[model samples]
Target chain A: MRITALAGGVGGARFLRGLRTHLDRSPGLADTELTIIGNTGDDISLFGLRVCPDLDTLLYTLGGGIHEGQGWGRADESHRLLGELAAYGAVPQWFTLGDLDFGTHVVRSQWLGQGLSLSEVTTRLARRWGLPDQRITLLPMSDSPVETHVVVEDEDGQRAIHFQEWWVRYQASIPAQRFQAVGMDRATAAPGVLDAIRGADVVLLPPSNPVVSIGIILGVPGVRDALRGTTAPVVGVSPLIGGMPVRGHADACLAAIGVESTAAAVAGLYEDFLDGWLVAPEDEASVRLPRATVRSRPLLMTDTDAAADIAGAALDLARELAA
Target chain B: MRITALAGGVGGARFLRGLRTHLDRSPGLADTELTIIGNTGDDISLFGLRVCPDLDTLLYTLGGGIHEGQGWGRADESHRLLGELAAYGAVPQWFTLGDLDFGTHVVRSQWLGQGLSLSEVTTRLARRWGLPDQRITLLPMSDSPVETHVVVEDEDGQRAIHFQEWWVRYQASIPAQRFQAVGMDRATAAPGVLDAIRGADVVLLPPSNPVVSIGIILGVPGVRDALRGTTAPVVGVSPLIGGMPVRGHADACLAAIGVESTAAAVAGLYEDFLDGWLVAPEDEASVRLPRATVRSRPLLMTDTDAAADIAGAALDLARELAA
Candidate 1:
């Protein structure tokens, strides 16, 4: 079976890690291909280099080079560069660029300046990291620049800030009015992005932020339309469990969009295209999902083995819907 | 009094350290304005980021932040970035970029891309380093890119190689034919370069590589002419003492240029413009200067104090000529 997964950052990376593990162990799932369409809204220009945080997370996680503890960047990282940049009074100083990770951005920036598309540049970077051929194909949502900004009201009144500054710098301390994906109105889906969804036997949306992660992908022209028209079953795993985010500030983002931080609310956002929904057993009693067949299970992926179990359960649900 | 100094890498840096120390203590030299025109012939672009060896040497040395033992870069530099870049098979693996130093290059490369001249960029970078307010001005020979290449005869016949590859990569093991400043024919001196010479009370050349370092500076259009016409006395300290170069591949470059490595031979190269020459006592017997007055002294600056003594002696010679 050819499976296409729509993913964001940490949560999506964890789910993909589990899915890969399950596929590797299943004897009957031979010749299965995984294509991951990653969100690029969190991309930023840092220290005069282009840094795609979400894409790097996915690449490092799948290529077996991610930091096991932080769940992002490269393992065995150093902060010598970060310290120097700080000394120079670089703005938006909260996010750390580990020494090992800066090399990736350096190469990407150089290649991008040389007239290569983000997708082509990503392929070259993945090849350098020793990613397996045909096992996983990573694609960015668009080649053009798209940034996620947060409009917030603090003691100084209302203003818009880059997603990184709002998320990493402020630690989501202020009240957010709304989340905006700047430049998405005119943005076209990257080459092969729509085709990946159209050709897949099943589509999986991992447990990533609904408003900024998956919602940003849906905001691109014709992407949500593509999902609605696809014949394959589209499944979404809830990022929220027990009224809180699994990790990071997903609740803050949900609040920005005026949506309650509940599995039911998240499911409603994707109900038009989703055919199956997976939620935690705790939230199964109160959740009201439309049209989509809802399934309750242990949604937490505490380890690689546990994550594979969750991925296997999601795949089984998709298979039952197809039958 | 205005003082002009010509410098190269580590050895010249050490001499300037002494020169600064001496000037700080001298009663009459408290208001002396020092102008250091660093050699840019050793500059190269690695992975699309400019790496300026000589200018960085001067910056770190005068800024009091250079590694004491290594004589270049930050004191607590780390190479995590270079190791990662190597894993990606980046070419020209000889020169390493410390993580801290990489930030400097990224800023410089960004400014250069935005149409800033090298002189303007250097001024900005110096300000970030917390340099004294106009205590010293560092200028590149020209804002235009000019690289010194070494013509070497290997088993594959003669080929012109970049100066860094010749010195750092090959360690100057092969026989070289000539040293050529590739873009000097059409290059103009950077703004303020000619004015610095004309306004100076004395011009002193430190013991830098005569062929590649000081030679490339003179190769720029109007620079040599300015030196010849300046009312200020121009004096040069020998990079060679007792028929041998003090440090680096100066001897190899001298061989390539068909000049025997000796104090008198180096003096002959500067005879048309220079008014005085400083040599070590050991080479006093062989010294034969035509236009410049020659003086023999203990020319080796073993420490900061020793470097100041050498600078004092050079200034005394200039003052005597003025009297």
Candidate 2:
């Protein structure tokens, strides 16, 4: 069976790892072919180096080279390059880009500079991580640039900054007035995105930021249409549990747009395409879905085993909906 | 007194280190201002990063961060980026560019991409190393591209390869027919090259590769004219000892032009502008000069002490010629 997953950076990758583990541990899912459409809205070019933070996180995590504690970047990484860059007084100093990570940036930036589309460059980079053997395909949501920009009110007035600066530099502390994924009006989905959705046996949304991760993907032209029109069940695992995010600044991002950081509100936001919803057991009583099949599960992914169990529950819900 | 020096990479850097030490140790020379005209023939673009090998060696060495044993690059440097770059199958595997060294390249490439000349970018980088405190100003031989290409007879036929490929990859084993500094014809001296020569009290050429290093510098339009027309006494130290180069593939490079690796032969190559020559004590008897004052010293830079002594002797010779 072919499974399509939409992912962001660390949290999404963690969930996907669990799903892959669950498939391996379970029988019938052995031949499952997984194709992940990753969010590229967070991608940016700094110092002429193309840095795809979300896409790189997926590559490093799945390839078993991720900084396990941080869930992003390479393990045993050094910031020598970044330190030296700062010494030169290069701007945008808050981002902690590692030396090993710079290697990926250098290669990707070189390819992109040579005129390769973000999607094409991403697919080529995944090959280095042994993606074929893992039966996992990672692709950017679109070939064109769709950078997310956040509008905030400073002392002067209201202004916009790239999402990276807002998220990394400010720690999302300032309330964002609005979030906009620039260039979404003209950009269609990447080459295989619609095809993967149309051909999938099931579509799973991991526990990633709904505002920027899956939300940005859905903003692309025809992406929501494809998701809503696909015959397969579209299941979502809420990133929020017990009125807060599992990890990341998702709560802050959600609050920027005035959405309560609750599992039920998250499910409500995806009510159009979501056919099945997996909420945490603690918040089961609070969820009020009009039509989707809602299931309660222990959603604390404290360990691999817990993550696998949560993933198992979500898959079971999707299977029931499909039947 | 104002002193100007011509230099290359490792050997040139070693000589400069010695010269800087000699200036520091000698009485009444503490206030001497030094300017180094570095060869840019070995500069290459790897993975789209502008790497000026000769200028970098001078920066790292004079700035006290050079790999003391190797006489080039940074000490305690890591190749994590280089290793990962190779894993991605990036080419030009022969050169071992360390991670710290890559920082310099990245900064330089970015600056060059921003429309800064190679000379301007170099001066900005030197600021980070406290060049002013060292009483040193380093400039490229030419702001325009002046890459040396080596013509060699391959199995297919005679073809020109980059000087780096000829020197590093082939190890200079293939007999070179000739050397060409591509784009040297249209290239003029860098901003201060001629001024440094005209303004100098003494000019010294360190023991560097005569053909590719000093020869390429002189190939730039107006550089040779500056050397010959300058009122300052010009002196050179033989890289060749009795009948062989002390280091590098200089002997192989000189052989390409049919010049014997002897003290008198090297001096004859520079006979036009040379006013004094410094050779090894062992090679003093064989030295034959038509016009320049010839002197002998222990030319092997076995240590800083030995190198300082040689530098001192060369400066003394230049002073005598001036008188």
Candidate 3:
């Protein structure tokens, strides 16, 4: 079975960890091929080097080099590079770029400078992590530069900052007016992104940020149409469990888009394409989406085992909806 | 006093340390302005970053960040970036790029990509090290790219490899046919280079690699003529002592150029423009240059004190010649 998924950073990577564990243990599912369509909305260029945060999270997490404690970056990373950059008063010092992590960005930036597309560069990086040999393919939503910016009202006036600044630096302390994925209008889905959705046995949407993660992927031209038109069942796990995000600044981003931080509200945004929706048992009462199979389960991914159980629930829901 | 110096990497940096120490301790030389014309032939672009080995050596050494034992790079440097880079199978893993050093390259490469001349970029970097505030200026031999390539016979037939590959990786084991500083003919002296020589109270050549280091500096257009015509005496300290190079691959490089590794042979290369020469006391008997004021001293720069003593001797010789 080929499972196509969309992801962002930490939250999505953790959920996928569950799915990977589930796929490994499930009988007759040993041949499962995983295809991840990662969010490129968080991509930014610092000091002329292109940094793809979401793709790197997936690479580090799935490849087993991730800092298990922080849920992102290399395990043995050092911030010497970032510290040195800050000493020079280089801009945007808030976004933490570790020395070990900088190596990947350096290589990717060099390859991209030589005319390779984001997809090609991501593949090369993934290959370094032995992901391709594991039969897991990770692709960016689009080759085009699609950076998510957060519009916030500051002391001076309203201004837009890169999503990372709002998310990582400020901890989303200031109220966000809106979220914009710049350049999304012209970005076509990268090669194999549409195909993965169109031909997959199941399309799973991990619990990545909806306003900027999966939302940016769906904003790509022809992607929403492909998701709605695909023969495969589309299932999603709510990023929010009990009226709060399991991790990250998803709730703040959701509030900016005027969406209630509830599993039901989160699923309602995907009602047009979702064939199945998984919510926490406690939040099941609030969700009432039609056409999609509404299932409730223990959604807190406290461990890989818990994540596998949640992954199993999502996959079973998809199988039932298809039946 | 205004002193202009020509230099390379390790040896030059050590000599400059001594020179700086000497100026600091001398009663009337407290306000001495030092200008260094550093060799650019060893500069190479790695992973799209412009790595300037000599300039960085000067910066780290003089600015008090140099690795004391190695005479290059930052102290307390971490190799995490290089280790990660190697894991990705990035080529030329033989070259060690510490995390701290990579930061300088990133800033420089970005500045260069933004159309800043290398001299301007070097100034910016030196300012980060507070070099300008110290009344010391470091200029590249030329603003233009002039990488030294060592031509050698190999199993794949005769081919040119970067000087770093020959020096660092092969340890200059392969017999070099010739050292070619590609693009040397067109490279103009960087701004302030000619003026530094013309306005110099004294022009001093440190014990750098005479062939690839000081030799390439003179190869720049009008530099040798400036040295010959300048009213200030041109004095050189031999890198060789007791018929052997004090440090580095100078012996192999000289051998490749058909020059014997002797203080006398090395002085002959500088005879046309040299006004004074310093050889070790042991090798003074073998020297035969007639026009220059020949002197003997303890030439090995074993420590900053030794370097300062050597610097004093070179300055004294230049003063004697001027008298």
Q: Score the docking of each candidate (DockQ).
A: 0.63, 0.67, 0.73
CAPRI accuracy category, model 3:
medium
Per-residue lDDT over A1-323 for candidate 2, one digit per residue giving the tens place of the 0 to 100 score: 89998889988888888888899889888679899999999999787687899999999988888998888889999988887777776767788888899999998878878898888888788888887788898989998888999999988689999999999999888789989999888788999999998889999999999999988998888788989999999999989889888777898888887889899989888899999999888989999899898899878888677877888888999899999
- Restricting to chain A, the TM-score for each candidate equals 0.97, 0.98, 0.98
Residue A297's lDDT in candidate 1: 97
**How would you encode candidate 3's per-residue C-alpha lDDT over A257-283 as one tens digit per residue?**
999999888888888899999988889
Q: Flag regions of model 2 displaced more than 4 Å.
A: none
Give lDDT per model, in order. Answer: 0.86, 0.88, 0.90
Better of 1 and 2 by lDDT: 2
Off by over 4 Å in 3: none
Write model 1 residue lDDT over B1-323, tens digit each, in one string. 88887778887777777777778899977778888888888999887788888988888888877888777887878888888788776676789788888877877887787789999888877777655563778888889899989899878998999999988899888888988888877788888898998889999898888888888888888888889999999988888889888678788888888888888999888988988888999998899776788898998877778888998888788877777
List TM-score per model, in order. Answer: 0.95, 0.96, 0.97
Reference-based lDDT, residue B100, model 1: 85
Can you give the lDDT of residue A207 in candidate 2? 91
Q: How many Å off is the CA of B134 in candidate 1?
A: 8.5
Per-residue accuracy of model 1 over A88-108 as CA lDDT, tens digit each: 665556888898999898888
